[model samples]
Target chain A: MTTAKRDTYTPETLLTVAVQVFIERGYDGTSMEHLSKAAGISKSSIYHHVTGKEELLRRAVSRALDELFGILDEEHARVGSAAERLEYVVRRMVEVLMAELPYVTLLLRVRGNTGTERWALERRREFDHRVADLLRAAAAEGDVRSDVEVRLATRLVFGMINSIVEWYRPDGLDGRGGSGGAGEREVVDAVARLVFGGLRKAS
Target chain B: MTTAKRDTYTPETLLTVAVQVFIERGYDGTSMEHLSKAAGISKSSIYHHVTGKEELLRRAVSRALDELFGILDEEHARVGSAAERLEYVVRRMVEVLMAELPYVTLLLRVRGNTGTERWALERRREFDHRVADLLRAAAAEGDVRSDVEVRLATRLVFGMINSIVEWYRPDGLDGRGGSGGAGEREVVDAVARLVFGGLRKAS
Candidate 1:
C-alpha cells in the first residue's frame, strides 16, 4: 500500500488522510509532523490545506454530524408513523455511518477535550434528543412499550446503534454476500425486530 | 485537587492517579511522563510502583475483568430459571461496572494497540462470549426470541450496559433522590424491560 504513487492532494483528500491518522494515533497523539508524514507533504504544505489538527477534527466531526442530522430532515423520516420514522432514521443512521466510516469513527471517539469536541458532543446530544422525541411520540401513540422512560429508551437504542463504529469493519463486510448497504440494513432490521418483537419465542 | 498533596503512593494510589489521566488523555495518548506528573511522582518512581504503563493498564483491566467474570459465577447467575439468570447477570454487570467504573472504563476503551491492550480485548471478549452463551441457552429454552441472532442481541445488550460509563456521573446521580448504584440499577431495570418485553405494546 505504501508503494502506491500519489498525485496532487486536495483539501478533501487531505481531510480523509488526516482523519485516518487522527483515528489511529488519536487526536491528541497526532501532531502536524505526523499529519505531514501521513499526507506525504511538508508540515507547511499541510498547514496550507488546513489550519491545524483541531480544524481537521472539526471538519471530520462536522461531516459526521451533518449526515446524522440530515436523517431527521428526510421526507420518509419526517412524514411516517413514529415507529416507521424511527426505523427509517435507524436505517439511515447506519447507512450514513458506513458511507462516511472514517469521519464517523473519528466523531464517535471524540473525548470532549477540545472546543471542537465539545461542539461535536453538543450537536450529537441534539441528534439524540430529536430521536428521543420520535421515540416518545411512538410510545404516546401506543405503538411501542411505554414502560421505559423515553429518554432512557432512546439512549439504550442509541447505544446499541452507535456502538457499531467500535467493531463494524467495512472491509470485512464487502467480501460477504450482501450489498453495500446490507450490513446497515441488517442492523436496522435487527434493531427493529429486537425493539418491537423482542428475543422471546413467539407464544 | 493537586494542592492537597501526598508524599507516598501505593499501587492503589498510583492506579487512581493513572486512571484519571487515562480517562482524560486516553490510554494511547498518555505517557509515563504524563502519569508521573499526574501522580506527583518521578517517572522512575512510577516504574517502582508498577513495572510500566502497560502493567498499570493490565492491572486495571484485570481488576475489571475479575469483577465482570465474578458476576457470571455468582449463585444468582448460576442457579435460576434462564430468564432469572439472565436478569441476575445483567443487574450484577451494571453493579460491577459502577463499582469498578474507572477501571472498567479503561478496559472498555482499550483498542488492542499493544500486547496489554490485546490481552484485555481478548479477555473482555471471553467475558462477552460467556454472557452470549447464557443468552444462547436462554434462547434455546424458548425464552428469548429466536428471530434475532443471539450474537447480535448479546452485542447490543452489552453495548447498552457499557455505555453507562460514558455519561453517568456519580455526583449527578447523588444529587438526585438516589445514592450510588441507583444509576446502574435503573439501567439494569431498563435493559431487562427492553430485552424481555421489548418496545412493542402487548396484544
Candidate 2:
C-alpha cells in the first residue's frame, strides 16, 4: 500500500514478485523456494517479511478483494436507478479488474484448495450478491430485459467481466491485450455497451 | 466415449476420475499416485489404462479441443451469413463446453507447463482465430456493431464463453452453480442474447 521507492523490497514489493510466481506456478505448486528464487531474496528473507506462502496469497487476494468490494460503496453504484446503477457497477468493475489485473487474475483462479482460497471464494460470493441485487431491482423497474432471469444474466455478465483476467495482457502482445492508457478505458466502454446495448446505444 | 456402466473402470471411466482430481488439485499438484488413489485403483492399474498423469491431461484436453473444432465443420457454422455462422459457432460452443465440461475445464486450465498444455494452448488459439474471421466477416457485412473493435469483441465473447467452465457445476451443490437440465440451454441463449443482442433478439 505504500508508494515506496522501486528499489526497496518491502512486503508490498515482494508481493508483486510473489503474485507473479503464484500465477506462473499454480498456487499449490508454488513454494517459498519458488518465491525466494523469483524475488531474488532468500527463504529466510521471505519468511522475515511474511508468515509464508499462504500469507502472501492472503495479502495478495485481500488487496484484490478490497479494490473490488470498494466499488459497491461508490456513490454512483449506491445512488442511481437500478439499471443505471447496474451499468455503473459493470463499467467500474471492468476498470478495476484491469487496474488490478495481476491480483484479480490470482483471485479468479482460486480453486478453494486452501483456507485462504475458501475465504476468498466466500467474499466473492458476497460481492456477487450485492451486484445481483442491483440487477434484480433493474429488472423489477423494467429498465432491464425481463426475458432472461436476473440471476442468469448476472452470472453471464460476471463471466464476461471476469474473462478479462484470463487473456488480457498489459503490453498488448496478445493482439487483444489491453495496452496503452486508453486500454482500460476502451474495455470499460465495450463492456458497458455489451451489457446494456439497448440502453447504451439508445442514448 | 463409450456408454459403459458406472461400475466398471475403463480408460474412459478412469478419465472422469482423473479429470476431477486435476480440477480439484490442479494439473501440476496432481500426481500419478493421487490419480490412482482417487480412482480407487492402483498406480499400476492407472498405468495399464493410460501412461501417466500427463497422458490423462493430454486425453482430457484432446476431448475438449476435438469437440470444439468439430463445431466449425458443422453445416450451420459453415454455410450461413457471417453473423449466422458466428451465432452457430457461439451456441454450439456453449453446448460443447457443457457436454465436455470436465475435459474443457482441464483444457482451459492448461498453463503450458508441459508439452500437452502447450499443445492445448496452440489448438485453442487456432480455434480463436477461426472465430475471429467469422466476426470480422460479420463486421464487414455490418451485422454486428462495428463500433467495437473485432479483436477486442472476440476476446470478450471468448471470455464469456470460456467462463462457463468456472462456475458451471451441473449438479448445483454450489448455490451459485449452474444447474437444471435446462442449464446449458439457458446458457446458450443467454450468451447468444448478450453477444448479438441486436441480431439475435430482433429475430
Candidate 3:
C-alpha cells in the first residue's frame, strides 16, 4: 500500500526530480533507490507522489508530447500558408525544446526499453509525422525549396533543431552561451532565417 | 583464466560486431556476454580479437576520428580561399559520413560513460573546433555571413550534417529507388551553396 500526505508532493514536482535523475543516470540505469536519493524523499514517499518509476516516465514524456502537439493546434500553425506555418512551427519547436529541455531530452533519448518508453516513442513519431505534413504542404506550395524530398528536409530540419539538446546549456556556462544576447529566441530566429532564407547573400 | 589462441580474431571484425551491439543496446547497457553471443564466439575468443569492450569502443571511435581528422589534412581543405575550402570540406563530409555511417554513428551516440567514451567525446570536440576554425576564417574573409556568430554557424552546419545518420539506412529496404539518385547529391550541394550564399534571390 502507498502512503499519502497532503502537503508532501505533486505529480509535477515529482516529475521534475525524476527527469533530472533520468538524465543523469540514464533511464535504463536509474532505479528506485537513485530516485529516492535524488528526490530527498523516501521510496514510499515517491510512490505516494506517483504510481511507480514508469508512471513518472510516462508523465514526463506526456508533458513534453503535450507541449509539442500543442504547437500544431495554435492558430498560426493551423491556418497559415504552409511556408508561414512551417516557419512558425520551426520557431515554436526551438522555444518548446528550450523551455522543456530536460523532459524533451529524455523523450528524445528513449530507446524503447519499457512500456512507457515505447509509448513515448510512438507519440514522438506522431508528432514528427504532423510536422512532416507541414513540410510537404510547403513543398507543394513551392514556397520552400523542392529540390530536397519533404521527408529528408523534415528530418534535417529536425536534426538541426533537436541537436540543441546535445549542447544547449540553459545556464549559459556549459561552453555554449545563453546570455550573449543569443537566448532561445535568437536560436529560433537563426534557424528560421537559415532554413527559409538559405545562407546566400541577398542581391 | 582467459585462453589465448594461435589463430586470432582481427580488431576490424570485432569492431563491426561491437558497433552493432552498441547501437542496439546503447553503450551503457551492453555487456561482454551480449557481445560474445552476437559474435557467435567464445568469451575467450573475444579477448583474442581485442583487449576488452573498452578497446573495441576505442578502436571503433578511432576509425571515425581518423576519417574526420583526415579531411582537415586534405589539399582542398588546406589551401584555397577559406570559403572554397569550407565548401570542399562540407561536401566531403557528407560523402565521408555516408561512407562511414556506422562508425560515425556510434561515435556520435557515445555519452562518455567510460574512459574510451570520454576520449571519443574529447576527440569529437577537437574535430568540431577544427571545423569551427574554418568557418571563422571564412567569416573573417567576409565570404560567409558576419551577422551570425562563427560558433553558431559552425554548430548549425554540424547539426545539418550529423542529422544524416539518424535517417540514413545504408541497408534499408527502400535503398533501391529512394534518394539514391542525383537527388541526394543535389541536397548536399544545395546545403553547401546555401551556407555560402544566403536564401534571398538576387535582383
Candidate 4:
C-alpha cells in the first residue's frame, strides 16, 4: 500500500522532482536512469508520463518561459512610461524568479546543448531584447542615465535580478528562521532602490 | 612531427583546455577522456601533467580565486575610507573578471560537487563576507544607503559582476569586432557609475 501511494505521481509532481534533480545534477549529466531513481519510479512509469527526459526539459523550461512572458502582458507592464515600465518589469522579474525558483533556475542554466535548450536560449534573448528596448526608450525620454549604454545596463540589471537563483533559499537554509531570511517584498524593493538610486547615500 | 607538435601541452595550456571543457560539459559530466580528446593529448600525457580531473579543477578555480582575493589587497582597497575602498574593489572586480574571464567563469559555476568545488565555494563565501564587511563599514560611515540591508545589496552587486562570464566574449563572438564590443575600460566605468549613481539620470 505504501509502495503504491509513494509511486503515484502526477505529471506536475513528476516535473517538480525532475527539476530538483536537474538543478542538483546538471541537465546534461542527468540520464533517464538517474531521473528514475530520483523520482522513485521506474523508467517505464516516467515514459508513460512524458516521452523522455528531453520532454521533461521542454516542459520545465516552457513553464518558466510562460511565467516570464506572462509578466510582459500585464497591464502595468503594457501601459506605463518607458522608465516606469522598465521598473515594473524589473520588480516583476524578481518576483517571478523567486516564485518559480527551481523551474526558472533550470531555465537560466540551459547551455543550448540540445534543440529544446536552443529554443529556450532564443526565447531568453527575445525577452532580454524586449527589456533592452524599454531601457532605450527610457534613455530617449531622458528618464534613465545615458552615459551607460542601454544594452549594457539592461544586461547588468538582468544579471543582478537573475542571480537570485544561485543563493536564495525560501526556507532559510542558513539556519535562520523564515522571517530572518530575505522576504520577497524586501528583495523587490532592494533591487528597485539599487537599480535606480544605487548604493550611495542620497546627499 | 605534426602529431608531436599538436600534442604539446604545458600545465597552463592544459588548464585552459580543461576549463573550457568544464564550462561546456559541466565538471561532473566531463571525464578525463573528454579532457584528453579536447586537448588532443593522450590520457597518459594528461596524467603526466596532473593527478586527475580534480587537480585540473583545483588549479583552475585557484587561479580565479587568487585573482579575486588579490583585489582586496590592493592599496586602494586597503587604504581608503570604506566607500572609496568598496568602489575601487567593485571596479577592480570587473577588470579582474574580464581579464581572467574563463577562469572566473569556471569559478562562478562551481556547485560544490567535489572537495575542490567545496573549497572553492568556501573561499567564495569568505570573499563575499569580506566585501560585505566593507559595505557594512561604508554604511556605518554614512556613505552608503542604509535602507537596504548590506548583505542583500552586496549579493546583487556581486551577481551583476559575476554574470559577466555568462555572455562576455573577449573575441566578440557575436561577430562584432573587438573594438565594437564593450571595452574593459567601458565596462569598468559603467559598473562603477551604475553601482553608485545608478540608472536614474542625475538631476
Candidate 5:
C-alpha cells in the first residue's frame, strides 16, 4: 500500500473493514492477517490504529450496545403508559437497527466465546430484561394480553424484532421493487401491528 | 478410548456428537479433530462414519431440512383454509423447531460460505418461500390484515419464529419456575396467540 493510503486509514475506517471481515468470517475464524489483507494495509498499520482484533471487536459491539441501551433512556420510553413506551422503543429499535445494520448484526451474532463476547451477551440479556419489564407492566395494567406469560411474550416480540437483521438489506429495493422509504416504514408498522394486534384481522 | 466404546459408535450416534460440536464451535470453525475429541472416538472412526466434516454438515442440515419440509406435507398444513393452514404451519413450525432445536439452530446460522452451506441456505429460502406463499394466499382471501404487504409480513413473522432458536432452552425451566410441559405448551400457545391475535388485549 502507498504511504498516503496508509496515512489516510483511521481507526474508524479500519474498524469498518474489520467488522465486515468478522461478519463474513465468524469472529473466531477471523485473523489479523485477514483484516490486514482486506484493509490493504500491513499488519503493523492495523496495530497502530487499535491494539488487536479484540479491540476492534470491542469497539464494534460497544457501538451497537450503546445505541440499543440509548433506547431505554429516551423520554417516550420513560414517561408513557407501559404499552405505549414499549411501542416507541420497538419502533426505535427497528430504526436504530436499520441505521446501524452491520454493527448490530455483528452484535446479534456473538456466541460468547471470548471476554468481549461474554460482556456483549450479558448486556444483551440486560436489554431484553428491560423490555420484558415493560411488557410485564403492560400486562399488569391490562394493556397487553394476560393470557401469555410476560417473559414469553417479551421473547417472542423480540424474536420478531431482532430477526430483522437476518433478511433486511438497506441498500436493496423493497419486495415490490420500490425504494427504501416505504419498505422501511412498512417494517416498523408491520412489527408494531403484529406485536400488539397480530396477523389475524380484528373481529 | 476403549474398544467396546469404539465398537458402539454408529453413524447416528456419531452424528449426534458432531451436531453438538458444530453448534458450539460453529461448522466452519470445527474440524475432524474437534469432532473426534467431542465424540471420544478416533479421527479415523469419525471418517469411518462420514467422509469428512463437510459430509457431517451435509447430513446434519439435511436432517433439519427434511423435518421442516415434512411439515408442509402433513394433513393440517395441507387441508385447511389459507389462514387456518398458515396458522397450522406456524404452530407446527414452532413444535418442529423446538423438537429438533440443535439441528435447526445450526441450520439457521449457516452463512453460505461452503457448497453445503449454500445448499442449506437455498433449501431454507425455498421453505420460506413456500410459507410466504401461504401468507400470500391468506392475504388474498382477506383473512389477514391487508395493510401490511404480504411478503414483508411473511418475513417479519418468519423472523419471529426463527428467533426462538436463539433463546429457547428445552431443558430449562419457565420464568415462574414451572416444569417443561407447561413451559413447552406455553411457547406453542404464546407463538400462536402472538402470531394471530397479537399482544394487545381485545377491547
Candidate 6:
C-alpha cells in the first residue's frame, strides 16, 4: 500500500526529485534506483510516496498540463478580443513556463513512450487546439495577419513559447536571459511584444 | 577498429538507424545492443560501421552543426545588407531544418550528457551568437525594431525556427504544419514573413 503523504516524503517533494533525474538521464533511462539515489532516500521510501517512476512522471506532467489548460479558463483568456486574448494567453504561457520550469520542460520532452506520456501528449494537443481556434477567430476577424494560415501560425507561436523551456534558466533570482534583468516578467513582456508584432493586423 | 564502409552498413546507413533510435528511445537510453537489434545486424557488424553509439551521436550532431554553420559563410548571408542577410539566414534555416530533420532534431535535443553533447551545445551557441550579431547590426542600422533586445529577439526567432523538429513529420511530402497547399519553401516564406513582421522597423 502507498504510504500516506508527509511534508518531507510527500508526493510533491518526490516529484521534484523525479523530474530532475528524468531530465538529466532521460525518462526512459531513469530507474527507481536512480531516483532513490538522487533523492537521497531509500528505494522503499520512494515507493511509499508514489507507485513508481511513472507515477512521478504522471504527477509532473499533470502539473504542467493543468497550468496550460488552466490558462484557457482564465477570464482574460476567455473575455478579450481574439487577438487580445491570444496575446494574453501567449504572455501567460511564458509566465507559466517559467513558474513551472522543470515540470513544463519534462512535458515538452515527452515522446509518448508510455500511457501517461500519451495522455500528456493528448492534453497538450487539446490546449494547442484551443489556442489555435483563438488564432483562427482572430484571423477571420481580420485582427491577425491572414497571410500565414492560422494553424501554422499557432504552431510557430507555440514553438516560440515552448522553446523557452530549452533556455530561460531560472536561478535564485537575476535570471540570465532577461537582458540582465531580474525576473520572467521582462522576458514575457518582450515575447508578447514580438509575438503581437508578428500577429497583429496592419492598421 | 572501424570496418571499411559498405553500402548496407556504411556510416550513412548506420547513421540513419542511429538517429531514428536516438529520437525514439533517446541517445542515453540506447545501447550498442539496442542499436544492433534496431539495425537488424549483429553487434559486431554494427561496430564495423562505426566505433560505437557515441561516435554515431557525434557524427549526427556534427552533420547538423555543419549545415547550420555553413549558412553564415554563403555569399548571400555575407555580402547582403544586415537585414537582408538576416532574412536569407532565416529562410535558409527553415530549408535546412526540413532537409535535415532528424539530424537537426537530435542536435536541438542534446542535453550535454556526454562530451559530444557539450561540444554540440558549444557549437550551437556559436551559431546563435553569429545570428544575434547580425540582428544587432540590423537594429543598429535602423533596419530592425529597437523595442526588443536583440538577444531576446534572437532567442525567440531561433526558438521559433528550431522548434520545427518537434512538429515536422517528413515521410514523403505533405508536411503537416506547412499548410495544405505549400511546400517547405512556402513555410520558409511564411516564417520569413512572420519574423520580419516582428523585427522589421516600422515604415
Task: Tell me which residue pairs clash in candidate 3.
Answer: A197-B199, A198-B199, A199-B197, A199-B198, A200-B197, A200-B198, A201-B198
Candidate 2, after superposition: displacement of residue B193 in Å?
Answer: 1.3
Tens digit of per-residue lDDT, candidate 1, span A34-115 = 9888888787887777789999899899999999998898999989799889878877887788788898889888877899
Clashing pairs in 2: none
- Write out fnat for all predictions, comma-separated: 0.67, 0.33, 0.36, 0.84, 0.88, 0.45
**What does DockQ come to for candidate 2?**
0.34
lDDT of 6 at B163: 83
Highest-scoring model, DockQ: 4
lDDT of 4 by residue, B77-140 (tens): 9997999999999999999999999899989888787899999999998999899999999999
Where does model 6 exceed 4 Å of error? A1-7, A172-182, A198-203, B1-7, B172-182, B198-203
lDDT of 3 by residue, B122-196 (tens): 898888888888878877887766666667767887888898787666554343333433344665765565455
Worst 10 residues of 3 chain B by lDDT: B194-203
Candidate 6 interface RMSD, angstroms, 1 decimal: 4.6
Q: Model 6 — TM-score against the truth?
A: 0.87
* Candidate 2 positional error at B28, Å: 2.6
lDDT of 4 at B76: 98
Ranking by lDDT: 4, 5, 6, 2, 1, 3
Model 3 accuracy (lDDT, Cα): 0.78
TM-score of each: 0.88, 0.87, 0.87, 0.93, 0.91, 0.87
TM-score top scorer: 4
The candidate, 1 or 6, that scores higher on TM-score is 1
lDDT of 5 by residue, B119-140 (tens): 9988998998899899889988
Candidate scoring better on DockQ of 2 and 3: 3
Which ten contiguous residues of candidate 1 chain A have the minimum total lDDT? A173-182
Candidate 2 chain A: worst-modelled 10 consecutive residues by lDDT: A194-203
